[model samples]
Target: MKTVALVYSQHTAQTAELGGRIAAAWGSEVVYLDPDTTRLEDWMKYERFILGTPTYFDGELPDSWDEFLPELEDADLSGKKVAVYGLGDQQHYPVSFADGVGLLASYMEELGATIVGETSTEGYSYEHSVAERDGRFLGLVLDPTNQPELTDQRLAAWLEQLKVAFAG
Candidate 1:
């Protein structure tokens, strides 16, 4: 089985929801880390990462993730595979508000994580399974209105990719 570290800065319910999906579908153990915990081993042991969070203001980066990124400046994840996802208010903010995934992608780059690009707009997967599939064709449209349920197929495929990358 694979092990994935789902890191996020959000309410416990949200974090748990996402982590639960990953654990169940991917046959991977899941770890939920909030904004305050240390990420020292996260980079080494976990071959892949799923970063999640909510949008604050107009696509502005959350302080916790911001701080966390700099903290990882010394960590080496250059060859690891990483993907990002986020939940946010679509009506109240700019489209960029949902861009935490991108910021996290960039942050991983700083740490040497070879990003595979952002994952599907999990928000959509929670609700529209069809939209999630459409994402496979459209490449990541980032639907803020969509609520996605981390499906088995989706999680399994993602895990398989990371497993191959890590197998070296």
Candidate 2:
């Protein structure tokens, strides 16, 4: 089985829960990126790396992941599949919840990680959330309010696509 590392900086534990779902779905490993971790190396070492995080107030990105900016410059992810996901509440940060993943996506590209397809979601940042199930990048714009099932199912679908994309 291929390995996909789920890296995230979370507050409400929703991001961590998403990682659990993804791990269960793919039988992969969940690694935290907060306070520096040996798992960051897993990002380059694994066949696929999934960057997961929770959005902050007014679109503020997690401070810890910013460290990735410089480190990624020296890494090589060429043809190595990668994806990003973010979980956030619907009340705050009305927009830009999924922007963090895009930031990671940009860096992954610089490092040569092949971005599978589809990106961003706003809702379903919790356990059993579809984002983990699908394994794709998400933003969570409207979340449970606009479309309750939108985030989770979309996430699950993304995961499914990643499997196929890497397999092919």
lDDT of 2 by residue, 40-143 (tens): 46455667667676655555567667655666677777777776766555444444444555566666777777776565433334332223225544332224
The regions of model 2 sitting more than 4 angstroms off are: 10-12, 28-35, 39-41, 88-91, 119-146
lDDT of each: 0.55, 0.58
Off by over 4 Å in 1: 10-15, 117-168
Clashes of 1: 13
Residue-wise lDDT of candidate 1 within 89-163, one digit each (tens)?
445544454556556666677777776533445443232221122353111223324434434455556556655
Best by TM-score: 2
**Model 2: lowest-lDDT 10 consecutive positions:** 124-133
